[model samples]
Target: MHTLKRVRLAIFLGILPSLVIYLGIAVLPIAISFYYSFLNWDGFSPAVFVGLDNFIEIVKDIVFWSAVKNNIIMMGASLIFQIPLGLLLALLLNRPLKGIKIFRTIGFFPVVISSVIVSLTWGMLYNTEYGFINGILSAVGLDAWQHNWLGDPNWAMVSLCITYIWQNCGFFMVIFLSALQGVSNEVIEAAEMDGATGLKRVLFVTLPMIRDTLWVTVIFSISNSFRVFDLIYVMTAGGPAHNTEVMTIYMYNNSFTSLRFGYGSAVSIFILAFSLIVIYVANKFTNKDN
Candidate 1:
């Protein structure tokens, strides 16, 4: 019993610093935000109590609804684009080619790059003047299609989706690739021997084997969709009449730009609750699927 107690004490010591940081940075801020959400204050001023007013305003705000719609669009796009493309790339790279390592490295290159740099790179490419996309369109005599990619309301969300897919697909690719490596070669060979090949083998044998990983990736994609702010902020600043605005950016504008820190805190709480509900539903679905 004494030895067991000593082992537990050592384990506690090992995790103590991490626990402290997590509580201080994450838990404390969330607790404070919950308290502040009921008040009315600029960040520096004395907070005045106004229970549920911030949340009430959120429900009535048209722009907030628009931002929620954008978030749903982003989530759908990420699900449709990121994981599927990643799985495709992972499957292709899983083959034993002459330069497989190089291909794998290239496939994962975007994920390692800073999000700011990725946003800037895509922003320049999507620029109206001196942008690669419009230049290509004009050079190919498709001038009618060339418009301000990020400035037009119709295209801003689409542009952001494409940029998001380009920037983050590699992450899921690497994830699926790692999971793919753990799949049994004997099982694969058995499927191959049983007349399974190409897409059939992938759809039937491989995908089922990595189903759990895919579910995890889906959850990651959903959570990442909610947290996406830096890239959109850098590229569009939720502009084009707020067509590309998402919850995080909306919250940021309320807190910092409009100086309604209390309302922003309420928005933050909403984001947290929304994310938790999504994750819960996803978990239930995945459990049922498994």
Candidate 2:
């Protein structure tokens, strides 16, 4: 009994720091936000208890709904483009080619680079007058395709989505690559012996073997889509009439810019609930598919 107690104590001590950090950074703030969501405060003055007024106002705000729509669009783009591109890149790089390490490093380079730098670089690339994309169009005699990529409402979200995909797909590539490496060589050889090669082998054997990892990437993609802020903020500031505004940016504008602490808290709470509900539905759907 004494030995068992000593082992438990040691294990508790080992995890105590992480537990405390999680509580301080995650649990405590959530609790505080929940409390603040019920009040009417502007970061100063007396906080008036407003109950559900803030939430009701949020529901009525069309701009808030627009931000929610933008977030959903971003989520869809990430799922459609980022994950598949990452998986494709991973599959391409999973072979025994010469200089493979160099290719893998290059593929993952964007993910390691700072988001601010990536945003700024992409911003320059999307510049209307002198951007690389427009320049290419002009040089190729397709000048009509060129427009204000970031400034135009129609293209802002699309541009941001493209940048988002380019910047983060490398992350999913590394993840999928690790999962691919874990797939048993014996199973692969067996599939090959059974005449399953190339696309047939990948589609049927490899993908099913890594389905769990794919599910994890899906969850990460969804979470990252909701949490996206700095990249879009630095690039467009959700600008050109808030065309690319997301829930996080909306929460920031309300909390800090507009100084509506209560309203911002309510927005944050709603974001949490919304993310959880979506993730839950996705989990159920993926399980059903399985």
Candidate 3:
């Protein structure tokens, strides 16, 4: 009885600090944000109760809608490029080849490198005159393909998406690689013995086994894409005509630039709600095959 009590006490003690930290750091802020969302406050003045007005204002906000559209585009881009490319990379590197470790490390290096640096590098790459990408295109007689990537409204979002895919695909590639390693070699050999080879083996055997991992990667990529801000901010600052404005960027502008803290909180809440719903639905699909 004494030992049971001691173990219980120890577990409670170990858990107490984390619970306190979470309450203070995460829970408290979310609660405060919720409270603030209902009031008109500039973040410094006395708050006034406005109930659902802030939320209503959000529906009327055009930039909010635009940001939402941009986020959806980013999510689509992640689905189109990041997941497939990451899987392809994982498949290629999963084989036993000399210097494969080096290749894997090199591939994942961009993911660990600071996003600020990646943004800056991509910004330079998109510069129309002297940027490396445009320079190469010009050298190859594709000079007309070069444009002010970050300055054009039509291409700004796509340009940012390209950078996002470049910076993040490798991380997911590593994840897929790890999951690929988890696939049973015996099953693969059996499939081969049954005359399944090449794309057939990959499609029928390898892919089905790794469906859970693929789902996880897809969901994570989707979530990350929705929350994108840093790259867009550094590269274009929601640019030429607010083309790359994501929800977070829109929220930041409302909060800081416009000093509409209450409205910004409302936007944040909407983003949070929408993101959670999307993630939850994605989780259902991801777990369906499991």
Candidate 4:
């Protein structure tokens, strides 16, 4: 008991500083934000209590709904594009081969780069006239395909989705690669002995082993989608007339641009609640025994 007590005391001492910092930066702000959500304030003017009014307005706002739709699209795109591509590339590169380390480094390079840089780079590539993408289209005698990539309402969100995939798939690739390396060689050999090879090996032998990792990545991808602001903000600022607005951008515009602190706080609370519920649901699905 004394030894255990000593260990506990050491652990407490070790964690106390970090715990305090976490509470100060994360927990306290969230609590304050929740309290502020129930009021009317222009961020500077005196706050007035207005119970449920902000939430009610959020539910009715057409722009809020639009932002929600965009967020869903981003989540879907991440799952459909990034995760699968990551898994596929991880599979391809998991083999013992020459220059594999180089390939891995290249795969993870973009993830280390700042998101702002990625957005700005994509912004240039999407420019109407001199952008490489449009230049290639025009060169191929498809001038009709060349337009203002970020300005087109129909394609702006699509452009953002593609940029997101390019920048993030590498991170997931590294994750899935590490998880793949952890899979048991005995199980793999057993699958091969049972005539499972290629796609069959991957489907029945490999994916099942890393199911938990996949779910964790999915949850991460979904949560990241909810919080995505910088890329879209840099690329479109949630425009061509709010075509690319997402939840984070909506909250940002309300809190900063419009200076509606109370309403923005309410939006932030909604973001928190929605993310928690989604993550909870995803956790349920991640249970391997089920």
Candidate 5:
């Protein structure tokens, strides 16, 4: 009993710091933001209680809706591109080839690199006149295919999506790779003996073994899509008429740029609500599928 009590006390001590930090940084700020959402205040002025005004204003703003649309686009692109690409890369790297470790490192390099640097590098690559992409098109006698990649509204969101995919696919790749590595070699050999080879083996044996990891990556991708800010902010500042604006950027603009503390808090609340609702629906769908 004494030893068990000591172990339980140690476990609680180990978790207490993290719990406190989470409450301080995440829960506390969210509570404060919820409180502020009901007020009318410019950072400096005395707050006046104006319940639901901020939310009503947000509902009426077309820009907020546009931001929501862009966010959905980002989420869709991440789901469609990042997860599949990552899984493909992981499958390719899960072999016993020579120099496989080198290849794995190369595949995961982008994930470890700074996001700001990745955004800037991609921004240069997407430049209108002298960018690598347009230059390639011009060299191939396809100048007609080239346009202002980042400057044009038609292509700005597309450009951001491409950049976003490049920056984060490596992260999911590493995750999937770990899950694939954990898959039992005995199971794979058994599948092979049963005449399952290549694609058939991967589909029937490998993928099912790592099903939980795949779901985790899906949930993470959904949450990360909502949290994307610094990359898009640096790349376009949600520019070209806010074509690439997301909820986070919208919240930042309202809270800091426009100095509407209450309005921004209201926006934050909406962001939280939207994130929770979408995640909950996704969870329900996934559970039903399972």
Candidate 6:
């Protein structure tokens, strides 16, 4: 009985700090946001309770919809390009070749760098006048392809997506590499022996074995894709004609720039809800497969 009491006390003491920190850092703000979502507060004056008005305004806001659409595009682009490229890179590096460790390190270097640095680098690279990309295009007699990539609304989002893929693919490649290592070699060898080759082997054996890891990677990639802000902000500042506005950017502009705290909170709540739904649906299928 004394041992049980001491054990309980030790457990309580260990968890007490975590509970306080969680409430202070995570739970408290979420609660405040939920409370503020129903009120009109400019961050300077008293909050006025305007229940559901913010939500109604959000529904009617064209810019909000545009931001949402842009996020969806970002998410789709990441799904289509980032993970597949990461997987391919991981597969290539998984083999034992001369200086392969150096290649793997190079692939992961971008992820360790700050997003601001990556964005600035890419921004300069996309510069129309004397940027490396345009310089190369002009040098190669493809001057027509050299335009203001970041300034053009049609290309701004695409350009940002490319930068995002370049920045994060390394991290996902590491994740896939770890997961790929866990794949049973004997299973792969047996499949190979049964006449499965190349794409067929990957589809029939490797993919199914790594299904859980793929689902996890996809969920995280989707979340990160949807939450993109720094690259877009540094590169386009939501851009020439608001062509690259995402939900978080919209929220930031409303909360900080426009001083519409209540409205921003409402937008945040919408984003949170949407993201939760997406992750939930994804997990439903993923967990079911378990």
Error of 6 at 90 (Å): 0.9
Of candidate 5, the 10-residue stretch with the lowest lDDT total is 281-290
The global C-alpha lDDT for each of the candidates, from Candidate 1 onward, is 0.95, 0.96, 0.90, 0.93, 0.93, 0.91
Model 4 is weakest, by summed lDDT over 10 consecutive residues, at 281-290
Q: How accurate locally is residue 33 in candidate 4, as Cα lDDT from 0 to 100?
A: 98
Write the residue-wise lDDT of candidate 2 on 91-198 in tens digits.
999999999999999999999999999999999999998899999999999989999999999999999999999999999999999999999999999999999999
Every candidate's CA RMSD: 1.2, 1.2, 1.8, 1.3, 1.5, 1.8
Q: List the candidate 4 regions with Cα displacement exceeding 4 Å.
A: 288-290
Steric clash pairs (candidate 1): none
Q: Please provide TM-scores, in order, for all candidate models, with all chains considered together.
A: 0.97, 0.97, 0.94, 0.96, 0.96, 0.94
lDDT by residue (93-177, candidate 5, tens digit) is: 9899999999989988888898899899998899887899999999999999998998899999999999889889999999999
Please state the error at residue 280 of candidate 6 in Å: 1.2
Ten consecutive residues with minimal summed lDDT in candidate 1?
Answer: 281-290
- Who is ahead in TM-score, 3 or 4? 4
Give every collision pair in model 4.
none
lDDT of 6 at 27: 85
Q: Enumerate clash totals for all models, in the order shown.
A: 0, 0, 0, 0, 0, 0
Q: Which 10 consecutive residues of model 6 have the lowest summed lDDT?
A: 281-290
lDDT of 3 by residue, 1-290 (tens): 99999999999999999999999998898888888899898868888999999999889978789899999999989999999999999999999999999999999999999999999998999998889989999999998898888888888888899999999999899999999999999999999999999899999999999888888888898789878888888888897777788999998998999888888888888988988998899898877755
* Candidate 6 segments whose C-alpha is farther than 4 A from its true place: 1-12
Residue 189 shift from truth in candidate 6, angstroms: 2.5
| Residue 122 Cα positional deviation in candidate 6, in Å, after optimal superposition | 0.4
Better-scoring candidate (lDDT), 4 or 5: 4
